[model samples]
Target chain A: MKKTLALATGLAAALGLGQAAAQVSDDVVKIGVLNDQSGLYADITGQGSVLAARMAAEDFGGSVLGKKIEIVFGDHQNKPDVGSNIARQWLDVDKVDAIADVPTSSVALAIQEITKTKNRVFLISGAASSDLTGKACSPTGFHWTYDTYMLANGTGGALVKAGGDSWFFLTSDYAFGHALERDTGAAVTAAKGKVVGQVRHPLNTSDFSSFLLQAQASKAKIIGLANAGGDTINSIKQAAEFGIVAGGQRLAGLLVFITDVHSLGLKTAQGLVVTESFYWDLNDETRAWSKNFMAKHGGKAPTMVHAGVYSAVKHYLTAIKEAGTDEAGKVAEKMRQMPVNDFMTKNGQIRQDGRVMRDAYLLQVKKPEESKGPWDYYKVLSTIPAKDAFRPIEQSECPLVKKS
Target chain B: MFELLGVPPQALFGQLLLGLINGAFYAMLSLGLAVIFGMLNVINFTHGAQYMMGAFCAWMLLKFLGLNYWFALILAPIIIGAFGILLERLFLRRLYNLDHLYGLLLTFGLSLIIEGVFRNQFGSTGQPYDNPLPGGQNLGFMFLPYYRAWVVVASLLVCLATWFVIERTRLGAYLRAATENPTLVQAFGINVPRMIMLTYGFGVGLAGLAGVLAAPIYQVSPLMGSNLIIIVFAVVVIGGMGSILGSVITGFALGVVEGLTKVFYPEASSTVIFVIMAIVLLVRPAGLFGQTR
Candidate 1:
């Protein structure tokens, strides 16, 4: 009886070992692309970010460490509670390894906290809040595409240097807007520029005539737009109509995207100086990848957020393959250790505070005559190197940095 | 150099002008809603969607047929009004005997469908509509865009003309009579059903006209109406439903109030209208202009 029991136990142990081997060979990696899919920010990040992630997965040979990569997506509707709920579900229930392209600063910050608690990865691409790296930085969160600090330094500094010394801000009244306004105001001040006056407008305001008039009255040399998406488009369009630019007061778009330029068209958006981390037409690599992306996305060029999603996903997968495990902590560590080299970033490295250092560009919206065709919108003014573009690590004020 | 209420004269006058321009839109939209509700006894929740359709149609006309703003101004209303007629005949006609909530629900559902379809086709990014009348006259105090001035004037003219036809004409009397006693009007050998349908169409046409005027000022977007419609509804409520002159006056007055709020306490600009709405509801439940049934 004892001999028979020993043989049965050995058989069970061998079976368990075999099952573990099978699990190692057939692991699955899941990522969730969460953002405002149906609301205002939908045009900037929505389904396009999903398509970009899918492209990244395909480019990464569809798998990492012999595990098939799967992509999932959800619409946060630009609400913090909704975004946090989805992040919780994606982490606890669905076992999603990462969440990417979260727009709307409030939603992104909410998800960032949830991701930290769950020990999951968050690749923030669309949000522009500097606080993500500042006081609220999470070890599990990597701010990928752009941030308010970069925008303020690039566009605000450039505008100040170009003789737009006096400024008035048409700020969108929210966390994102406040951060942008504060950062740009600081940048303007640092460059010896003065902010004469400012007015805060509600988010998604349809009319800007009154706001523009207020800015016009300030007689500030520059009208700094600390807004994004539809708000930016409306303000720029109305500013033109009010002859703010022709009246000799320039407009500086602190967080303008290529998609906004397309919406406004070169005729109305001409000569508007803006800043971004990536432009599709920056080089052959970006153009080729964007062409592939555009083909799948109904001829809409990939915005920096979409490109950032692609780069983040590809880099995350590479990190997973190197780490040889989908354990969130180890994968995040690997991701930070490795340099991000892709179409979107050149030798970009994620800092201890999880801010991805990347080059930012100052771009001027091309005049109608200068644009060759559709999506030909930007005239690259100058490139701010990765080191100079992002906020310095010593000033990040991140809790994680102190621990590290 | 002078300041009024701590704001520069240019800023104050400019905001007031802006407020008036916004008021023009509110007046036009609420006028249409009042006209439709007066006779149809149906609250058209799809008004905003129809308004959005007007802008989209104008854009399509410009893109496909090379129709300019002037052509679109005339043609879009007629085309959209025809669609309104179809809606009244096929769907709305069935809901007359049911609860009024049914009409609201149906129209609301239709708006969602229309907005969804447009979002799918064009995405949410706005398409720019060229300002037909570019450049503004610097009036020393403020820079007044010709296009903005044109919108205010056009909307006012249209609203007044609508009010005149409804309040002062034989046709309007017949329309009022039909609203009061449709069966009696039908007994008098007048086609009451046809008149009701045409009135709804005309009401919808006013919205289309507003949309066309709005295309240049705001981005031509599927969401343009949805955003403006909520504020317009508040204006309609504050003015009292089914009151023509009340809607027109309240809309303009509220816009100026909102503009002043921007100059004084900018944070309250959005909520000032709602605050007034709450006060009006408490003071006069039927609205400033509406009569109790």
Candidate 2:
């Protein structure tokens, strides 16, 4: 990425543009990471995301095109208004060039509209709704991590193939949950599986037994959890008590992070098949990067969101250097053209619809006695290839995708 | 023989049972609030935090000292109650002479601080507590977990015990006398301040006990209390601010209402409690079991 950026910067300079340093606004390249810093999703993307962007800047030598690289972050608190308010302020008053890592899909979708109108870059590393790249796609936006479509295809498809065919969804009544359910439900239908029933519970609900009872009554072979964070943890915990699993039903965690597994411990989270794009213990490179991250993150492994933040920041800065300017359009084009190469992702492409097309892994949580040590949770089963995994451009609702 | 709104009778029975189980927590929590408001005349807004603290206390007890669920159930409440006694001495005691808002504000701010510290230390993903009784009996219509059944019974026993002590005993006579006229009670040689402080501690203890009951079900997280506290407040208000019997009954009844919402609409489950609270307030300002002051 660095070599490609330098070559592009040189080419742009030769093509009659000013030097990259002179093109930088305010003599600095600023990137802002917006996410939930203080709520239920906090542990997944909160301060750790901020820490990730900083690590990214540091790893990138803290500068691009002879301009200092700066990172700023804010807490959305899982509220869309709060997220957009902070974002508008960052763009107008603070002169932030690009916004990265807005999780909480409702908040992410809101920020998407604002950043589009503002004509600034947006890099999404959180929020699982496939709609970000679907109807809501923007020219300046780039989805770097996982999304609902990939999760539906990865976890949902595999479960159906495994004879956990009949489905019942316990959805969180919000944008992310709705998107996940719709996408996963579609995946089930495509695979000749029947959806028994679905119940949309409010976010942050403490009790899930009533919903679990309804799911049990549906008598579905698989209970597809279309929620994230605390909602997911509670559903799984309560399902155990209600004898949902003991009664021959399987749980499919559509979007489970390592932090969730850590919180749940191997005791309850064991045997749960989850789909995610990145895992820290995947290879030596991931381990080396994660160890440094874990040191700063209180010995906690990086969730895919954290890794996505780091990768997105590094790529965004590279794009700016490559384009020889901080303009949103040129940099975004450069980003889309350059393949995403990092520890967790290999040759990941940013599709025209802003979906980061990358291979995702299907993981099953090892039982309590599977025994390596703490944080040694997942047994990687198979990789869901990028072309086969992501929603094809032909089927996209995104206006950016040219209809053939 | 019967069906209500397209839901089967069997499913309805399961939902009703689930609602009753949820009501157990509400009854326990609102009962604490009523006790404190009835005696202290200051709304104990920290009830949720006290409950969260109780769960955290239980988690810590098991993690650090090898204390089991049974032991933590007894000790977590006492520890949190002792902490509550400290709160009464240090901060809440100073606001008894002022308007009710003062106590509410102080406790609300304190709740933020307490929750903030816990969030910083523990993070919000939540820690899991092992269920003492893991397996359940299949009731044919629904699976009934032994632990959940135990939770309902335990909360009922606690509520009845609290009501008996406050409304029936000799100590209860003096407490009620103090509630009416603390001056006369003090003049009659009763240590009114000490008694008031102990009453506050006891109420907070009830919140802690409810927390222990919830820990096994919901993962122990800092924001766990905040999520349910608003609804619990609605439960208390609809039950009539300081009515013990009112809070106890309203808590359970509202839980069933919320459960039905989850069945029919599902989206309005969180709001149904407040909706009921609004209607109840308009119809009977003093609540179902509350006497007009």
Candidate 3:
């Protein structure tokens, strides 16, 4: 009996040393939330994302494999060089296990490369570029939020079906805007619709009178606003003053956040079609989670980017626990193997190309009267399934796909 | 029916008109800058923040006090200008005898602090203000929003009135004399210090009025003034600093030029104003209307 008890103790110690105790590097798991904290994209992703990441850590029992979870954040100021510098410091000096919630595509792409070289996980939630998963897919990068392709598929298809065929585009002149225009233009033309004209405006532009005049001259049935955050809000508000909608030209917001709707108020933003992967009022679970988030966030509801950060961090933590280590490649494999379930996501699956396959909803901005209360902005038009929502495997250009 | 270099005549005409509307803002903003410089011998770098404060004041009045747009139009400037008066007394009054650089540095730092504080209070996503003149008439050339037309007419009146006061009145003469000989003006019992304070307040009032007018066209955001302030400064430089009539004319002309660029190239619209400023500085240095000191 004494020999048996000693043998059991020795085996338990060996297993613990081999697995959980010895594998996690740095004695703690650190996540760096890098995004625009004081620029145009600030309200959309800023400190809300950091808070979401912290909430995720707390929800996951506050630690992984006996290592305390730490969330650190930095403001990228929507600049690529600034974002890359922060990412380098976080990975090399601070030993951050992952970086998440980078918004600007230029900045995210820059950080993606650096994080890949450093062998750290990149859980992108705020950026909209498809290239992160298309041609630039890294083994350690997981695009966990909506992308340009998903936006084009969901909102573009909805508008085409609603009898708004001929389109004009007001594109923000940047990587995300260009990709959205390109992908949506393809989707529009594929549906037997015509693109009449397109004008590229500089990012963070305040005035849209000139651009709106150009679109009004085009006489397209629909005007697609391929921009986000402050730029989107300004264009929409200016469009109303110019009577773009009253003149029978509908504005399609390819990407719109709840915060933007709140900023514009429901009166101006009504009747616009938008695509998003998550909304705070989607279901009971989302409501429970969002209420807590709202209380902590000064009564502001979380944008999809914020929700994605929370979900992705939670999943990353789970994957680390499951894989028994925070090794970038191994944990990434484990994350891809496990299906994601969260407050907003019901059936989320990560593909081999590092894209989070999730259902994006087709939504229409509710009229002021239709809104039941504050933060009640969208009414889901249709449920776009994960398979139909994301880029089909055959069309994927990522090298990770076997092409089978 | 005719096309000029790729753009149709109608489009060209429309864009030029739009340029004038934008120029209205430039004229009003630079007019204030010119007034402060001409009277106080200090470059008011805080003009942009003062403008932003004007818009925020309008927003606060409406959101907190239930005041309408028309009320904001008249009251916002007075309120913000009073705040500007406090700034002048508490800070700007100290650097009157120093080099111009000292004043510029002090004003520039104050502006950053003001902008940063506002940004912290309201996230970068701007708040929307209702349009007072929602209805518009479509001119034959393009869709002409009524607000745009009002902006042009209203600013022209304000500019003329301001120009008349500074260039054609007795008080204007006293102000000019004080700039040239403050001690003599003081011995004449004109209260030169009080005149300087009022001058700063008046200049800041103009910025606040421009902000109230702009609250609808642009979202009431902290960065709105900064975004357009650079262009207005270029207008001031191109018009020649401290020249009242020069600021007004150059403001409208540069605006028309910027509009034409938006129509033809679109990409260069933002840079077109700066390019003209550079060229003007290279050629005339004192500006198109400035007397070389």
Query: What is candidate 3's CA lDDT for residue B160?
Result: 99
Candidate models: Cα lDDT each: 0.89, 0.91, 0.90
TM-score for each candidate, following the candidate numbering: 0.95, 0.97, 0.96
Say which prediction, candidate 1 or candidate 3, comes out ahead on DockQ. 1
lDDT of 1 at A244: 86
Q: How do the candidates rank by DockQ, highest first?
A: 2, 1, 3
Candidate 1 i-RMS: 1.0
Candidate 1 collision pairs? none
lDDT of predicted model 1: 0.89
Candidate 3 residue-wise lDDT, B216-269, digit = tens: 988888888788888889999999999999999999998899877777777677
Residue-by-residue lDDT tens digits, candidate 2, B1-293: 67877998889988898889899999999999999999999888888899999999999999999999999999999999999999999999999999999999999999999999999999999899999998988888889999999999999999999999989999988998999999999999999999999999999999999999999999999999999889889998998888998899988988898888899999999988878888888999887777888
Best by TM-score: 2
Per-residue lDDT tens digits for candidate 3, residues A14-88, read 657345646889867999999988778888999999999999999998877766789999999888988888898
Model 3 alpha-carbon drift over 4 Å, by segment: A1-19
- Stretches off by above 4 angstroms in model 1 are A1-27, B1-3
lDDT score for candidate 3 against the true structure? 0.90
TM-score of candidate 2 against the unseen true structure = 0.97
